[model samples]
Target: MHKFHLSIAALAGASVIALAAPVQAQDTAAQAPDAANSDIIVTAQRKQEKVTEVPISITVANQAQLERQQVNTMNDLNRIAPSLEIQQAPGQNTGGGGSIRGIGTQTFSAGAVASVGVVVDQVSQGNANISDLFDVSRIEVLKGPQGTLFGLTTSAGVINITTNAPDFHAFSARVRGELSDAGTAGSKFGNQVLQGVVNLPLASNAAIRVSGVANMRQGVNRNLTTGDLNDNDRYGVRARLLWEPADKLTVNLIGDYARARAENGGDFFTFIKTSTGVGSEIANCGLVAREGNQNYCTSQSYVGHTENYGGSLQIDYQAEPFTLTSITALRRSTETGYSAASNVFRADPLALQVANGPVNRHLSLFTQEFRISSPSDQFFEYTAGAFYSRQKQTRDPETLSVMLTLFPGMTIPLVDPATTGAGANDKIVDESLAFFGQGTFHLSPGLRLIAGGRYTTDRLSLDRYNYATAVASNTVLNVGNFSWKLGAQYDLARNAMVYATASRGFKGGQIATPSAPAVPFVVLPEIPTAYEAGLKTTLFGGWVADLSLFYQKIKDFQAQQCTVDSNSVISCVQRNIDGVKSRGAEINFFGKVFDGLSLNTGFIYAKATYPTGFVGTDGTVIGGTQLAYAPKYKFTLSGEYEVPVTSRFNGFLAVDTVWKSRIRYEANSRSETTFRPHWLVGGRIGVRTEDDRYSLSVFGRNLFNVHEPSLIQSDFPFGGAANIGAIYGPQSFRQVGLSFDAKF
Candidate 1:
């Protein structure tokens, strides 16, 4: 395997280098200029500049890269970015976790927060509600801490994706089709999709661009008894309008909706009692049983429909070297489906059973921001902004319970209402206001300094009332904090620069758990400080390389702890008790190595540890443990070559690989073994027309058929000790499919 990987790497490198070689033939006099020499522009610092000239560590995947690499969603981006990871929930209530540099939340709760922030066209996507894949122009990932420009939510940096804009000079249309085969564990899962887009010029200065997509995929699992269905069909669509009435103002109205009615049928675990038979090993909050079936796991399924609609109005006006902009946006989402596990009935064969049910949630938000920036002069460049937002989220009724039959001599124990209660609902309201300013100053011809700070005020109110259980509570809290950043850069040569920076970042304090009537309660807020140094260089006018090392310390880290009280109502305690220290290094390189070829690679080494304490399910304190879902080492490399076939036809081939060390789930606080280490390799072969007007391509992903589970666990007893009943979807297997894309 080592030799195989080395050979592939060598071939890819050679191909890329060949792409950059000067053309030797005058045969086709009609050939276009080499694409590699075009200047790449980016907006990493809230301003447009050459990508290679940006001081911060950044990665950009433009439209050409996306089309060549076949990147469609967050998951595709994950496979290529060594510093990032994305995973769906394993089963019900499993937290959806994404990690960057070994730091992130590992909870499936709607209220949980993610470590890295995702921003779409300047708007922060606070949650996964808007995570659907879409047609985009570019994706930019700024590594390390992003306090000065992105704010507190960016303690672990930021991912910004920008979509294509309407063109007034061109009237065009395109269509695409895809057929895919995926899954592992000897299962057959198929996926199909169709997409189309049109750009129309309504008038000289106004245009409209609209796109729609429909996709369907089948799951690998099947119900034992029903034989009916478990994992099956899912689909969605998006319509957008971009209107520019004048040169200074633009309005974009977007409406997109997605629905999945397929069986949520994923893998899950059942509990087995310890030798003492005092407690079960399962971690779910509650359990229930239906008919007589000894230890048979209950069937799990998912059925839900979600709708997302929003509008962004942006106004930009420039006067001399100063520019002012205003942005207004709104988003709303509602999801209703089951949020329970089926392990209860599977573990207790004699226990009465209950079918799965719904866990409904609705969220609404409105945000506005105004900013002014002055173009860089001989002396200074400055940017200042003010932002405000209002959000509301509601969770309706999450309940489960069971009735057990006892032996003749055994007595039935009384159950707590908190555990089997009905009409349990949660409501949260969040409002924030902030003002920030940053400036860059050139002290000498080759030296630059930057300083910035932000002051923010946040307020939150939460209410949880279980009407049927007669339990209710409400709380409100307000917090104010100031974060700052400072950096200095010195150029060592025309194509190389060295820099050092220090920044303070934070995550907003969360609402206290309403039902936890503890001795002393407070909102858990996270304050992290980061220090970093790095080198940026451009080689051969084609390759861009960046290397950075960083250390971050977080105080009062917020995490959820499940505590079983005598009343049986599991208390979700939120506390600001623990502290975490993290350190890591990252290296990124992208360039053309040869004629008609491109290469991109990244490496990351990160480690995170809890310095204070973490609470266990049994109410025991565990100290000095590693955080879950974070790998210690990760790397990725990809390269592609384009081959000319005819004046109207072109062909291309590409290979990409990712490798990472093992990661622990549940923060390794529990004694369970949940995951293993793995590596993945994929390749693509396709052809496109010279003008890029019409194309047909065949591609294969996960060519090695590796079972690199994104999430794993060892608590399901049905599969036995060594097996521990793992609940994971096979990442993807060797798939060969042909795609057709046309433009008119």
Candidate 2:
């Protein structure tokens, strides 16, 4: 806690230093004319427009900035955007534990969908969302309800990712490699990354671009029982082809495959406390982690693997008065292996062994979209689109309980007993269709009125069979909703804009297949009504600043709640809460203050909670409780400065820091499920050529070795005192490495 307090002071000092440098920077402004570009083109509105000119709150990070900050995964992104939090829950290969403005899906059910959508290129992702940020052009984070333009999943917001397209005019290739070590703190060359991109010019009007990446890292936590934990290896390759079949038509074809494997690392387990007694565990948490061993299983090795592959095609044609576009995509994601953390909730385990049988899951998705747009220059500008999506999911039976043990008085692992047959198979299919449109009516040269809406229909079916009881469950549910937006934006000046909007967003109802006979097969959809106001402006040379305030109320909020019956049987499913409220303010600033110094900062003050008058069947009081993963306040700051050394080379330094208030992993506000406020800091120092053709740098992450978890849970099945389970962040330990980059 002291360290966290010190970090705040440190960041305050840094800000003071930054405030003091502008005066000196003004004197050297003439010598450093290459400042930041204040105006950046974006597709926030489904059409191209300057980011600051848009009426929504947004944060943009380009490839150079991402690489400079060493942001390679979803968790790393949370530090750059205060309003976003990516939690990779243990044993889950897919990216589902993510929230925008403290609203997201937290269930581990294979069929559950996230409220915050992730869009790659122009294709919306289902269960196959990519986990690695490899070879991307830029990322745009849009806050607030984007359902009118993004579709059913984006009730809260959207993470829009656009990769580099094939450059028909260029034939070039480049490769980058990085290696880092933490000595006794970590493995030798514990983290390594290699990635490359190649552009091939084919016919006169056609080209293809291929990019691939391989990243391997050793787990920072040690399993005092045996070897290190959470060792991971991931690799993937992406290929895109751009072809202009005719003078007025363009086509893009894309395909990619990626795979990740890890040992007892899929879940973060640190010893928080044990139900048994004190001095009993040094490190214990996450379902029941014991001292000295993160996974702490002696029976069978814990391992898991996840694979994702997909293909998409996009065609665009320019007509006389409008543009026509079509997008089609198919994606499949699979996970197979045993997850120790997954089973710990069903039984009191003497050691770590998730299930009696290997856990396997498969997800398939198909999407089609068509859109038409008129030029933005028109007085009445408009965009309209139709979208269709289908998803199929299946999970193999997992043996949740067994009597197998390695020792007499100790439960080391699982081995199914012949006397009992336990497990079940789950299958689900979901389909959705929607039509959406948005338009702007120009009232005058400096003012415009905007309106948009989406009409969607959804259907879901599920089948689950229990082996022991021979009980089968078959269910189907259908739902429909319409969401809309009303707003107005005004240009205060050439470099400033102000806007206010009232919007309604919808998240489709949820369906799940329980172990045997499903009690609640469907959950009603959630509807959020929101009012927001914001201002975007440019100041101090090329610096850009934005301030926004919002309030939202949601009815029938969906959340995952679990229970254990008297028979020692656990039933986990999606449940709808009475009401949810979110109100907050945000500030974002990015760009150069002057000369060679640049700063990027984002802060969020959000109060997300469930209102009073709501009680649980288990007698758990949750009235006025904050939602899980929703921190009351968060702040992120990063800065970089360039020092001119000579005509041929220059030296530079960069630093970043993130601080978040205390958060609970469960909406019930349980005492055991809490992560104290914490801070993370990173730095880099390097030398580069004046023309920027080549450069080398030394970087360090988690400079303070802050060990903090992104998620926490109660040891549900335990009998003694309250026990906590936690999964730490990706950069939980200190790591320093060397990096090299070249362009030719």
Winning model by TM-score: 2
Backbone clashes, candidate 1: 25
Error of 2 at 161 (Å): 0.5
TM-score of each: 0.83, 0.89
lDDT of each: 0.60, 0.72
TM-score of 1: 0.83
For each of the candidates, the C-alpha root-mean-square deviation to the true structure, in angstroms, is 8.5, 8.0
lDDT of 2 at 665: 65
Q: Candidate 2's residue-wise lDDT over 1-744, tens digit each? A: 232234335434534543453221111111111223455666888876777889999987766667778877776788778888887766442344568788777775666677788888888887776877877777788888898788547888888887877766656555565666436334222667766676777988998988888777766544544544456778899999999989989999999999988776454555455565422432232234442223443324567888999999999999958999999999998888866444453223343334446779888999999999998787999989999999999887776653434555765323342213366777888899999999999989999999999999988887877675667777787888889999999999989999999999988777755553334377778888888999999888567798999998888777876554433343556688757888899999976777778788999999998778666433677777677778989998888888888989989898888898988766564666666788888878999888675678888777776766765555533441265555654566677777766544
lDDT of 1 by residue, 1-744 (tens): 232234335434534543454433111101212233544567778777666666777776666566556665465777657777776553222112455676655443434455577777777656534544556667787765565676326766777777666666656555565555533222244455556566666777766667665555443333433433244343455555667676765666555556554454333332222221213321122222111111223344455455555666666777557888787777776666654242223333333333334667787778788889897765798889998877788887755443444653453433423454344678878788889888889999889998988888988777777655566777777889888889998989887889888888767767654332332235566788888888988866767787989898888866655333443233445656456877889998876656687888899888777675665543456566556667788888888888899888899888878887876655335444434566777666788888766677776666666545444443322222232323333244344565666555
Candidate 1, residue 312: Cα displacement in angstroms equals: 1.3
